[model samples]
Target chain A: MTQPTLGVWDVAAVSALLLINGALSVWLSLGIARQLLVAALRMVAQLAAVGALLTVLFGAASPIWTLAMASAMVLFAGYEVTARQTRRLAGGWGPGLGTATMALAAATVTLVALVGPLRPDPWHEARVAIPLFGMILGNAMTGVGLGLDTLTTAVVRDRAALDARIALGAPRFEALRPVIREAMRRGLIPVINAMAACGVVFLPGMMTGQILAGAPPGDAVLYQVLIMILIAGATGLGLLGAIVGGAWRLTDHRHRLRLDRLAPARPAS
Target chain B: MTNAEILTLRGLTSTALKDCNLTVAPGEIVVVQGPSGSGKSLLLRAIADLDPHQGAAWLGPLDRARMSGPAWRRMVRYVAAEPAWWADRVGDHMRHPKRAAELAVSLGLAADCLDWPVTRLSTGEKQRLGLARALEDHPPVLLLDEPTAALDDAATRAVEALLKRRRDDGVAMVLVTHSDAQAARLANRRLMIRDGCLRDAVS
Candidate 1:
């Protein structure tokens, strides 16, 4: 086996891909160059680390460790995504820390077993199952994080009018109806816009990767569509969690927005 | 609530307050006098429990600290010289009307001022709208901070006339004005804030 072709894995190739992504980073997220760089670095490290672990386990021909690693991947991705979104509303880190991990694990298991006909034994086919879950959950993490950020900022800015609604005999959640609607509007609009621009602007990463692996274009597109649907569903659920749960931070038990917490700005003198 | 919608402050010390004791009985007009930056407005806010101070302040039966922030403001109407403008329309005032059409009519404003956008309103119109908003609330304690500062002759006369009517109806008011003519025409209790202290007006 002629080293499986040096073209398949090369440092220069990877570096070139990173450089291109860095150059395009400005287009992806403006005014946040450092954040994009850090994200790219994280992506490289996380994928490479996982790739190495899987190779070692599979190379040793052990199925059990491979299955455990895949499970761990799903759990970790989900937990991190959920934690980032809900930490602010939970008021402290500990309450919503691992909830996302659980959500992701359940979604992954449900997708593999019930949603799709892909019934390969996870223990035997650890590579496919683990990486698939990683991509699925990773997309969800992004959507959820963005959704929560939008929701929090909107709530903070429009807090006065929002609280005014509450005082006018609107229920706490009812009072936040306008804000909640605006948050969801902002959260969903970006993803929908990107999806519209897909294919024409740039081949999605999943479809492109599939085509590079010599898969048929049509088949790759089909797979990408399925994955996209799953991601949207996951995103919707995650945003719902953020909107409903975050309502508590805006108001107390009596349906009054915490005004003492939002004291009017005082003069510096 | 209680008759004492405003918190009673005795010797309240803060950057916004001097050593002062203030009691605003229900249905009484108490106008505060001072030149610029003497903390007259701050004293009103302090009585409203909107200021941070060391002195004890009681609102009705509850301590100022204990009652919720929204509840406290609901009982006290504070019309700063420049009220916050969230929209461009005068009509949106009906969105949360504390009073009815009587005051709007009393101020010689057409009912359409209710529908008029804030952008279309003159400075005098906004001040009138602010006063109308305060009156709509019908709070037992009316805190006026330079209510006429932004007005021309006509708007000031209109506001003065409406305030007189409200006073006749026995709505308690705390008017903060630098104009002696304005105070002499409107105040039942005349107090001056000077160098962070409150005392009866010398005149």
Candidate 2:
């Protein structure tokens, strides 16, 4: 029964699919190509480095090092979101959104660790928990950036109403509640749609890969479903948390919105 | 003695308000007038501490730089020449619906305007909103920079009347305007700001 229906070459086939999709993305969007190329090259270098290290580390390294690496990944993800957005604005808003990234990654890791089957050694299973947590944070980071950009644009676009609020009796965040809510919804739509389309439009990469590696198809599908739910949950946390967490910065101590703090549009990139 | 001079600017220099020294007395309506770029509005901004100035500013007898930012701002409210906006609907700013209605009616604006988005409101209506904000907050002194420069005659009158009423209520007002008629309408004292200095009108 172990008649090797597919050789190691099958892994090559999967990687080829990743490249085709990446090339198609480049052809359709040059800007996306810039991001995708950086992401792809970085991913390969990191995964190869990790693979090389694992043979020795798993055999002898401390579990503490593995856990430390996970924490660092989450922190860096948060910082990445903050610096990327903050550099564009005048003040602390970028770091403020970084708080969203931290919350997102934490919630994902927490949910997986608490609800899923306990690994024989979670800290040691750097292979499983770290990758999964990272993927969730990465996706949620995209959603957050979209949501934050929308919120910033909406605030500026609606500046008159905002100024009037300070003129009136409304508090800063109180005045911006509606726009923030809308931006959160906008940022979340793509991720939610993906969740809904799962198993219908295409089998997700996690499930397909697991099945190819000799896991029962049903088992892989079950885990895939769980992961999808986790992703959606983490993204929701990121979108909602970011919208609320950052309201304080936008408003003055007297509860008035600070219009000058908004990031202006850059020369058309 | 002058209720501790709600706003005092010394050695104030700015593109908005050039080298100047002035005191805004408690409960007095003071209008600043000059041609554009003469720093009439800059005087108000310098007092409010919203713009950088070369000298010292005092709010209610406290050095502005010495006081905590929040404390200084609480004592002084700065209304820009172009009103700043951050909301979509006008009514949304009125956290209290009843006050919104009262303010809209008093400002010669329809109560339905509360429901209207800020985008739909004319420049004049928006200015009224800016003024309404300054008034609603009940700040001791109002630093207005050409608050009526962008308004129509009717809107202008409505705002002027409100300022007149506020002045009668003993609220100190710093009104920056090029229109002498506007200065005469509400200001008990019209100080001329020219060449980075404040002077009593020769007349």
Candidate 3:
């Protein structure tokens, strides 16, 4: 059975609940009334636009259309990754490295899931492939972004120690081992926490959405488990690629710490 | 052109230093004296291959460019003016704790100083330990920047004596110092740097 559809009035009724936030801002003199209004409006408009695009994409149901949308999402995620950094790599490497790693990891996992387990009639079915790709890409992007930021920041912070180690005859990778481990830990912690807390602490958004869409709870639970595993795999791969690639970029063949390759850190805002 | 030189720099140029040439025979110390920000540290860093430079440095016949950075650095160790210690405990930074403890005692550090947390170190104590860490390996060449800048008269003498012993063991050195008296006591040849240019200091 299909889930009940949401009408304009039903959406408006929920939207009106935001008035409580606006009223709270006004009463508390929080000075966030305008910001709250603008943010809510932006969310509504953006989601509405995405919904319209998805309707057309579902109607087309072509692999090319699905892949095109996925590419667009990955590109946007790449920008987000770089934008989130405090000290980005100099040159276009910040965006280039993030986009390349995220795309490689997320796409690989998504393709494997589509072909192996889901086995949709058309393996690249827009509905199944796009959402799966999107979910994996979102998590992978966050992991890669955090990993890269940590790598660059740590390299700068530990410049003297790294140089000392290098001077003491340690190989570049050996000298960077501590920083790389820290970056990997930072990137993977969120996914690990989410996995641990999924059923007991909170139902994941994907499973909640699936249950609301009238799917069997068992099926939805299985989907959530599969998706979570895929996300973890993608995030781990992405973080490894990004951090390793970053390490390579930050040092030269001479094994000197190439701080010049990093943009000077912006003063803390 | 003789093979007697353990370390040789031919036209080394860094961003802060102009083209420079020098050589140090085994058991010799070449003291570099300069005002602050006059590229003394940069000169040593370039020789150690820590900074990018435009010149050739040879450890005997082995050209620096031909060697891996770590291998080159291992052979030609550069101990910074304010050395960095990575680990929490003092002994963790040393490759050989037994030998380092011996060296530390010679440098006027307590016998148990190696077991002390790094946070407990005074600047003078850290300086001595940093020297001990570098000397533990007995590299062929030492590029030392102000090795005793933080030490008092007695501690400075202790460090100088240790450096003299290293030299007597055939380790060549390039030492940066601000004190003329220290240079006179340690240097086989003294050079002064100003505005990135190196010139022999009059005796």
Candidate 4:
């Protein structure tokens, strides 16, 4: 039950649907016509680039190439994490630590899934490894970034409260216990929400893509469930790493809240 | 204890305070008067090891650098002007509710105010509770920054009495205040800070 392939005219015909949307935007004075066109163009270009790369990758199916692509994906995701942070650690620590933790989490979970359950041919096949690694890295990066950003912001905003606790004889960890918990929760919320809303509220992208590619509905559901669980696990690990590492880097042995280590918050765009 | 330890700040400099040298004797009160932004608060923060500064500070023979920041802070507690409360219930912060009760009674807080939510506390209440919370740690040296600034005359007198009692109990105190009358009433020696330098105020 394979899906039919789209020819060039079919793509042009499908793209015409976007014209209707653009026309409606123009008619409504939404001022989003340019944005819609630009976004559509970007999507087409990005997908084409990705399609070309994937075709080469699938043909090669070499472990080294798969690992290299995975590494590149993790690196890009890590950069996105650091760039998204409102209040970040100064210097290389923010991005360096973030990337390190996200990679650790994504790699660990992906390996477990590959070896344990979804053992594809050659185990590290590009088709299985790249997409799995991509999903884990992308999700874990967001989680860790949220954790670090929230922790820093909370520390800065509640510094007086933290100092008061320290003054009252709280140890460093004890003083920061609440902030750390809040940060971890913030990091986990996205994954949790996705899990909660899966199947009932929305069909996840991976499941839809799998079904569109003519995979069995039951198989797609099973894979989606496994991926969601793996994402949650990766997110948890990455977030914990970021918060603990961030907390350690932000303070010294003397238990002083060395907020000086944090780069100043950037103004909202 | 140990001949009433002395707190000495020698050539301490921060962005706010210049090479300031001063000594505070245990059981003695040194009132610091200064214009706003004159670094009175910064002086206390530096001595408490809360901020980076040049030079040295010592409690008797123990150098500030020799001990951890927490250790130094535990010995020399700084009560900021606007204290912070993180806990929902006021009693959650009190290590010694019995002592707090006694202090609260003296400070005019209701008997059960400890059980009240911190969000319900007024600024004056928070200020008084901040003092009580600091005292719970029983720091040997006290760096008070305008502790009574938010209080009324009667409340101010009550705080003065409480602080004077602590002074008599052999606690070294550096009182940062703007009130000349408070200096006259409580200080054995009064110092004025202007342009980050400390000078002895004429009695």
Name the best candidate (by lDDT).
3
* Per-residue accuracy of model 2 over A23-57 as CA lDDT, tens digit each: 88778775575676688779878887877766655
What DockQ was computed for model 4? 0.60
Cα lDDT, model 3, residue A20: 92
Quality class of the docking in candidate 2, CAPRI style: incorrect
Classify candidate 3 by CAPRI docking class: medium
On residues B26-46, what C-alpha lDDT tens digit does candidate 2 reach at each position?
A: 768888877677777657655
Residue B7 in model 1: lDDT: 40
Question: Of the candidates shown, which would achieve the greatest DockQ relative to the real structure?
Answer: 3
lDDT of 1 by residue, A175-244 (tens): 7777677666665664576578778887889898887777889999988876666666665666666556
Task: Give the TM-score of chain A in candidate 4.
Answer: 0.92
Show model 2 residue runs off by greater than 4 Å.
A1-61, A64-104, A107-117, A151-164, A167-172, A175-183, A200-202, A232-269, B1-22, B35-81, B84-89, B95-112, B115-117, B129-140, B192-203
Give the lDDT of residue B68 in candidate 1. Answer: 58
Model 2 scores a C-alpha lDDT of 0.68
- Once fitted onto the true fold, the runs of candidate 1 whose alpha carbons sit more than 4 angstroms away are A1-6, A9-47, A53-181, A194-204, A207-226, A233-269, B1-21, B33-68, B96-102, B108-110, B192-203
> How high is the TM-score of chain A in model 1?
0.71
Query: Which should have the higher lDDT, number 1 or number 2?
Result: 2
TM-score of chain A of each: 0.71, 0.76, 0.95, 0.92
lDDT of 1 at B112: 60
Per-residue lDDT of B59-129 in model 1, one digit per residue for the tens? 55767567655565666656767664544566564444425455666666676677776777777766777
The Cα error of candidate 3 at residue B89, in Å, is 1.4
The TM-score of predicted model 3 comes to 0.96
Single out the weakest 10-residue window by summed lDDT for candidate 3 chain A.
A260-269
lDDT-based ranking: 3, 4, 2, 1
- A1-269, model 3: which lDDT tens digit per residue? 76888789998998777899999999999999999999999998988998999899989988888989998998899989988899989998979998999999999999999999999978888878888998999999989998999999999999998988888888888899989999999999889999999999999999998899899999999999999999999999999999999999998899888889998787433
TM-score of chain B of each: 0.86, 0.86, 0.96, 0.96
Residues A1-269 of candidate 4 have per-residue lDDT tens digits of 55977687889888888899999999999989999999999998988997899899999988888888888887788789888888889999978989999899899999999999999878988888888988888889878988888899999999999877776556688889999999999999999999999999999999999888889999999999999999999999988988999988877776767899998899632
